[model samples]
Target: MTESKAPGAQSSYEARKPQTRGRTRENTPLRHNFWVDLKELIAIPDVASRLKPPPKTNKRLGLRKTAWCVFHQVVGHNIRNCLALGFQLDELVRGNFLKDYLQEPQGALTTAAPTEDQGHEVPIHGEINTIAGGFSGGCTVSQRKKYAKGVMIVETQGLDLTLEPDLVFTKTNLRDVVSHDNDPVVISMVTTGRKVHHILMDQGSSTDVMFWLTFNKLQLSLDQVRPYVGCLYDFAGYQVEVRGNIQLCTTFTSDAASRTANIKYLVINAPSAYNILLDRPALNRIRAVASSRHMKMKLPSLEGIVIPMKSNQKDSKRCYENSLKTKRGVCSVTIQPPGED
Candidate 1:
């Protein structure tokens, strides 16, 4: 505060050194390697104090108890908290509600009451009466309740239950009765070398003949077959091709006499729907009769009908024409005498 001097006034008596230009190597500061040493120091435990425990409060609870309380409260707790506590609300509600729901009244769902027929069972001691008109020899009868469907039950004695059809039967063995009027028949075919049970027959088919399945089963090659186009009708009214030709050996015998007949058959592309058809041509060839009443065919000379190993084209043509006529919906077929044609 004593008489202030001006801002730039200074003394000139101090020593003056020469001014240096740019940076110089001699004036640089030194750096220490203490960082590596500091890391080593931190590795040692503190020599003074021990670790302390965390704070505790009455409001804090175990995870399971917290979840249980939160679930029971249902107000402040949310699904996330319930999941964290491992609590399932839906399962708990279902278990408790199911017991209560089942204990309620019986007609809660309004379901219909079951009728007697709905739970009907066949009686052990039920009486069986044969129906009046039946194709077979025997049928069983069971009385139907008023409200039940008009179903009659037929029973046959001494017959195996397992062999019977599921439907009620008015008669058993109707082939005998049906043959009296319609002349029932059965026709079967077997290739030359194969076994004899390969008979194929279909009542619904218009023609009875051999099929490729039997041909293949017989181990006969296609080259051995002669191609022939012939007509046949199936159950569905579709026309099928009689592909190749075959010859069967049949033996026919009657009480009076016995003879062998060589029968030729046309091959047809028969699907599994109809494997082999015993048409009128095959029936007329063997002079066979089918009885619808007894479900059997009678061949008086069945043993004498002989099918040869080789077939002739002329004989095959005659068989095909007969089968065609049979397939055309003709009711009956009778072979004309050999000299007539």
Candidate 2:
């Protein structure tokens, strides 16, 4: 038997019916796009490379019937099938990282293939046939050879290529250089204890050249030169092999003082009237200043005195005439091999 209730008290079914008196409305749920957001985030250039693979336990999860892509965090794919890798590679190429590496030309890549002389095969940059073996997908000979070749190319680009500026000028030098000059400023210098005349002071040339006839007359032996197998091109667009470089002590003397430098002369087996061509290196070493108006050169001596060497105008004109004659005579001269000369 229950006690009698108060007049204000309500039953549970009667209270619920009053709360539900307002009619029920239609349900509108929001759409979840987790996979799409994840894909976009992974495709970001900076973020693509840093994305790591999912944990092994997550990879082996039974949630998906097939594999999963950790990058997109979606099923039915993996990191190997990632679409962001192609975009990242394209970005690297456009940014010049790949262009610089592929464009450098100084490095020599040698293949293991033997020649008739059993010499090391030099791999040309673009020729695929020069590879040691046929191209295939595996840890094969061709792949290893190519890998080694690439490594050598990268290693050769280090400190050996660095060069410093050679500034050889002074305030007091070239104070009276006049404009509109036509004469070539040629001077004399001592090479290997002998006075060498008709030495052309060529500011345009990049190398110190010694003609074969003059080099032979100087009595310099072949063994004294370090073998240089590179080619040198002249102003007339003629290409020839640089025989070698022989080091010599070149001296410039005047009434006041004298200067000496160990100059490396590139031996060129060619016909030229000039005995020696004093190019930028020798001039820079001596700190020489040339003046066509004055028809002389001022060089800094070891004793701190400036020595002025007078130019040989007569010899310069004679050499110019001789060179013209030689050029006219050999208009269609055949270039022979180095050994044939």
Candidate 3:
């Protein structure tokens, strides 16, 4: 391969270099390594047909040599060093086409790394307090560990709002003038589409009661009464007789806001200060709170707004005075209508 040249001058490439005959495979930059030379692999009829030939070029770069690529069927390079051929073979290997022929060890990472797409879920960096209290009320371990730990073992998205935000009471809710604590929450409510006054909302009582006198005054049919199998308990002063209970549409209104529910009233034959006695059950049903000091009953309406019903102060004092008179046998129990308690 030695050729004579002028002093300090480079010789012609063809004269200085050994003749390759275009047969030598260029070192493949592609990373695909196979158990055998790709030239030998594509010998199979199926592989040969699938193999894509590199672009045909009639013009040779004046290299007077001959070496044929089986894949390209051209005189340039071997299939092993062909960039296009190597890439296609790597794709076939990844598709499990030449599994046994691959240089990558069995069960090794041969495929390209997976890319994140629309299906991949991103980590949501947020938490919600579905359970307010934890193991301890004071949150002994601080807020999270404090209260109701026995219940909050597993975190979860819980109940679909069976309750609204808790309503609170304030000093402004108190009566403008100091009223005696003896004042009762006696407000008017609509029942059977008629305004019924002297309805006492009492928390101490265990049942919602409508005296037989008011029951008759409403002109309700006896057929509407369903047989109540429960035991009857009498209030102080009279032996109460239990009439079958009836469900009535009773509405508590505070100006524009109102709440109405079919209340199952235990129609009782007894004399009391009020026409309708709403006890704990009724108060709870309407989600109401009665304060004698405030002289008003506040309840959440259907829309979750607080509605305030001011107690009839004049009627409340009258009932209190009459209650004293009744204890002294001054007021008769026969006319136990409104303002008699």
Candidate 4:
């Protein structure tokens, strides 16, 4: 066999950032997520023992079913589609074998700002155009008429929707988040290479919104704000004035996997507790599913991996408390010094 079939020593594996997203162009054979994560999680001696065996329902009855299950070692259901497996996985994710995969946004990788051509957007540099609260002032007649005409549909051109990963919600996801039944899902997101706190996942919103104070805090260039044509409504259906809109990439992360999506946010010149509000459109664009009850968000990452992230319970309480202050005309924001970020 000479040197063909024999290896004196193997080179150590180096984990590198993806050179190109899909169909990697680099000559390197291994991928960033090349390791079989499930297998690794299961390989742990403690984890392998902690996992309960598959139920009797997973056992194949005859030769008709071809969906093979790893847990049952049968053909009743596909391994990925197995509910028992997903449940156990989510359970283990909380504080067991899968804990290694759970991580905060601070540990995740963040990409730079988009280089795509931003349309000719007339940026407004002024601080506050309306009241601090979003619903305080209504929109103008012209804005109302424009909004009445048509709905603005954000185009999805650069989004990578190649893989469809399984998203599941069970008792495991609701473990610690549903105690008070008053927790609002608040999670930090990496936007423009910065960890932005108090990001609210508001599914009721038709479009994403960014507060003017938050926009300024991020130190984002005013040139990125595009003119938003339509008007936005408040809780009473009264049109609320919007400052402008900007498209920024926000990363949704879970344990060791993360996914980035370009989100078009309508910047509102209102002071509020929340820095940004992720709307239904943004969720759909990211292919994300949020469970307010569980206070968790899960998205499909590249290579069909399910990325799961949890909300900050303390931050959620803080945001809501601040929101209550805003409702009572007593809102306050901590001012950062010149040297601080």
Candidate 5:
């Protein structure tokens, strides 16, 4: 029987034996060393970080150099506009590696230093309760940390504003006693070569608005207006229709200094006492501070000098009276139609 073994049968059995042996591989232990595992865990995040393309410069596009985020020393975008870095910062706060930046901007020094355990440096100049807050309260850490590392600060030729302590409102500021009320800080600002009066500086508003009639009076035509689809709410609790939008180089000046800003104004056809209103957007742009009690607004000029604008109390009162008269006239008008009694 042994000699009778089929010659081809042995070859077939050998082939089947290899397949049967392959199943035993399941019992073999996975080759994992402590060093290898540790190395792999450490290399995981680096692998992901490398997936992003490197930042580069193109001369043909006439583009500025790409901003480098100082927080992580990445070469692509600056800290001001980096969302990933912002998220990391927030995560650090959540992890208790850094203090929450929800406090007011006091005398706390906002300086960063290197730490032993942290992968990157963090602001360690002040305690959690004494940390200096940012200018805006919109996003807790977004705007405040924009220039946190002091790497995005740039020098521009025109109207480069620098906050000065002297700009703070004081009791000595000249204000009209006759126009004392909760009325907005109405001042005169030069826009498009016209000394626009009755311009209300409203911090509560989120936009800079220019009445349609005032836009026309500025010698600007409807064709110059860009198409804008937006709604505005008025004091009468009605949604005012927006006609269009126009960008004008608005200038605010004092005797010693002057600052100009390219203000984007939403043109709306609405009747109000103010010819134009400068709101939070414009205020933040110019770094201007308003003091309703002082009846004035102040900002840093191009030369870093404090520029102050005093409210036009007399014109304010006059405009208020005119608005009241207009309101009364509209109320007195009666419409009659032919009807069967």
Candidate 6:
């Protein structure tokens, strides 16, 4: 007889031994297969949900077509017959088959007759024969192979498509130049009142504005012209001539507002034949500025010409502020009508 061992002694001792470290488990990083997931996710559904199909023309038509093709079997027909009878196929399978069939062949000779068979001479002009047969007649194996190969060649060579002709219209961006003859500052004296067309308010200029055209149109002569000298600058930092001067009374106005001003014309000698241009001096005199973005004018008295600010409001603000500051408080005095005065 042996003293009875303590009941739980062996079990407790075994538990304390850090349990024979069976192979240490390693954390292998998961390898993701994007193509595999895409394939599985787009696979057709199982039979049951597929059988009870929905209407054809609605949003679920694709899904319904897919389900119908998967679950509903055509007992007595091949794929061609099924297609002829208007049976839909799963979109994935159809698209895949189309892509593969439509793929341009890369190699020169895709198929040839079995050399062992001496009786079967391969036709050299297979494609022409098939075309002559008008596609309805079954194409010979050789012909089909040639057509596929030729089509692939054409596609791969990028020679099958015709180029479209360019149909764009081109125009010149003429710089408005004010000369002694065609002063930009124009005065339209009508029954409504005297309106000043400040050509200088247009920045796409190489010269300034005056009423020379208006003066000529109004039958005003050069006798009123006085000797005047003022330095004018262009966008490219080039100085322009402001030699001879002619004074006139002009009225300026907009639909909702109006103003009158005394316009002093400076002779401008420009290269091109432009009618009138409002140079910086005339712009400064009328307190006007041109906004390139908005394609409008801003006058001191009337509502400034509103040009569409560009996409960034901050840039637009900067442009407006810069223009205003550069041509500060300079303005022409509004003159009264001849009879009224």
- lDDT string for model 6 (43-162, tens) is 424312222232233222121223322222312222121221111222212223222322333222122221221111121222232112111111244544566677655444453223
Error of 3 at 19 (Å): 99
Show model 2 residue runs off by greater than 4 Å. Answer: 1-181, 328-341
lDDT of 6: 0.33
C-alpha lDDT score of every prediction, in listed order:
0.35, 0.53, 0.60, 0.59, 0.54, 0.33
Candidate 5 lDDT tens digits, 320-341: 7777765421111111112222
Model 1 TM-score on a 0 to 1 scale: 0.30
Off by over 4 Å in 1: 1-191, 196-206, 230-242, 251-260, 273-275, 302-341
lDDT of each residue in 220-325, candidate 3, tens digit only:
9999987654334333334346686888988999875888987878776766667887876678778788877778888888787788888888888777666665
For model 3 the local lDDT of residue 326 reads: 48
Worst 10 residues of 1 by lDDT: 47-56
Ranking by TM-score: 4, 5, 3, 2, 1, 6
At residue 202, candidate 6 shows an lDDT of 37
Task: Give me the overall lDDT of model 1.
Answer: 0.35
Clashes of each: 55, 0, 9, 1, 0, 30
lDDT of 1 at 264: 57
Lowest summed lDDT across 10 adjacent residues in model 5 is found at 329-338
lDDT of 2 by residue, 1-341 (tens): 33433333331221011123121221111112122344564565443443333323333222233655554354544433333332232333333323333332323322222212111111113324211111111123454456667765646445331222232445453454333346678788888778989888876554677878888888888889887533445445476546777889988888887778898787777777788877666787766778666668887665557688877778878877787877522111112223311
Over 1-341, each residue of candidate 1 has an lDDT whose tens digit, in order, gives: 22322333331222121133222322111111122232232222330011111122233222232232222232223323322121121222222322232333323422123222211111123347421211111111222122123334444456433422232223554422322333223333333644344243334332345666666766766776665432444444555555656665654333444445666555665554223456555565555555444434444343333221211223333444445555343222111111211
Candidate 4 C-alpha lDDT tens digits along 1-341: 22221222321222233344232234112111113455465566655665666445533522325545566566544444444444455444432334345553323423222221111011223345322222112134444345445457566678554678679999977777747556788888898989898988877645577888888889999899877544544544444556788889888776768888888887877657899887677888778888878888888886788888889888898888888776432122111112211
